[model samples]
Target: MNEFLAAGLVTALVAGFLGGGHCIGMCGGIVSALTFALPPSRRHPARIASLMLMYNLGRISSYTLAGTLVGGLGQLLVSNLQEVARILSWLAVIMLILMACYLGRWWQGLIRVEALGQHLWRYLEPLGRRLMPVTHPGQALLIGLIWGWLPCGLVYSMLILALSSGSALQGALLLLVFGLGTLPTLLLTGALARQVTSFFRQPLWRQASALLLLAFAFWQAMPLLGFARELPF
Candidate 1:
């Protein structure tokens, strides 16, 4: 793969990892609740792992679908207005920087951005409620699909990058990697909620992740300035 695409994938992964705090605040409760929803007899480690895996698969699947739709729109924009596509790519970098700031606790403007999705989430939340007390993996998966639509600034920031990708497949892959990146923290949340939360909550780690993300955003934006062509493998 070209370096540009590779960079994008890596950026997505890092963004997801850096956004662990946001995930914990947003989905941690639901994750714990889902675990409790499991039958008493199914609370063993193996069973819990299997169910959490299903839930994440469903969540990531939704992200991929969203990426495809937005990426297809990006493809059309690239075909019709190359300049506009370039502008959006720059916008994506700016959004990434803002994401880093948010992660670093430097600014909270992104939380306001999350309000943009609340109306839509209001509609989808009821559907999720109907799937309550997830009894089986299938039910967990369905609930997860619904939960994925929850309003989250971090997810919205990544969606901007996906939209700027200018290709459906690339956008899907980007989001898939991002989703995988989040797997480690979210997967462990059910079993080690306190430890995972505490680790991500550390200021040093958050600052480091945010700085790395800022560097990535700069790298992504550099090509637009004609400093380097998309590296050919």
Candidate 2:
């Protein structure tokens, strides 16, 4: 049970760190836009923090719904709970590696392969834009949920991880934690807007974050690589 909790927490942090990179790259604009949306009178840190939390709550709620649906389907595929759990464990390892590569920029090499998804995103892009002129916290929250499904390898990788949970509830909870982990970084970006975005874009930070993610990936996967049998868990 401890191991499972550890995996969930590690997965959440890694998901946030890795996904945060892409968030900086792509969704950074959203953060910036959100900052401007607020009236100056309501721009106090406390108020901003409350709005950020609400936004995250909405985003994480979407993740939970998605995970529950997928995990439910996964449960139906197996008669043995043990087998499902084993599958989830291995899938988490795989996601860890993929997210590591993604953060490292190594996964960019596969862009040619992923180009097909672009066509789908092209259609979805305009739909998201239609939600523009967001006037309320609820609007921003709902928009984030719609945008959550936006095609990106990072999100797809996490979705794969979510699917591995074997049970709907577990999958939902895992994704919620993952979303929560991402919340702070994103909230800061929203608050600071362009400055934070620029800071994250610094080559040094990117490289450092990438390396950190890679190290965590290995840490998460090492135990599963038959090393525990030779050493101690």
Candidate 3:
């Protein structure tokens, strides 16, 4: 269990870090809007930083909750019908591959999958807009919580990994770690929007991050592939 948790932590952190470019593409606009919501006089470095921190913490909390729910479902499934483990693992791999392709600029098939959430987002988006023109920490936090549900293939891919963990605690921890890894990039983006966005939007960054996602896919597949060494009798 300890080894499993450690591996999960590493995978979550790397995935989150490498997915920075995607994060910028998906959430940078939202960050920009929030940044601009402040009154000119209130936009000091310290004040902006604190609000961004609240936003990210709220976002990460949502991820953690999602992981807990999905991971718990996985646990229930695996416990009752052990064969389900194999199926869930494969699904996770497929999602990761699709995510990698999308991130790497190889293909953008995942956008169709992402489209599935639009119905829900349509309702939530209005609420998010209302919370905007943020004037307080509470409002910023609420905005982050709402935006956390924004549909992104990258986030869904990570959620799949959490589901494969087959334990609510593990899943929550995995997503928490992933969220932390993403925190620095987003916080910086809030402070220096154009510069940070331009840096992460680079083709090279996208491709490299895609490679990392592919590696994570393979890592998850290693056990299912039966790559464990045979005993030397």
User: lDDT of each prediction vs. the true structure?
Assistant: 0.85, 0.65, 0.84
Candidate 2 Cα errors over 4 Å, as ranges: 38-51, 80-91, 110-127, 229-233
Candidate 2 lands at a TM-score of 0.79
lDDT of 1 by residue, 64-149 (tens): 88888888889899999889888888989999999899989999899898999999999998988888877678877987888887
Candidate 2 per-residue C-alpha lDDT over 78-166 given as tens digits, one digit per residue, 9 for 90 to 100: 54555775676677666666666666676764345246567776876686678766557776777677666555665555556666655
Better of 1 and 3 by lDDT: 1
After superposing all C-alphas onto the true structure, candidate 1 shows an RMSD in angstroms of 1.7
User: lDDT per residue, candidate 3, 10-104, as tens digits?
Assistant: 77898888888889988898788778878898888788877888888889998899889999998998899988878887888899888889989
CA lDDT of 68 in candidate 1?
82
Score every model by TM-score. 0.94, 0.79, 0.94
Q: Which candidate's lDDT is highest?
A: 1
How many steric clashes between backbone atoms does each model show? 0, 0, 0
Off by over 4 Å in 3: 229-233
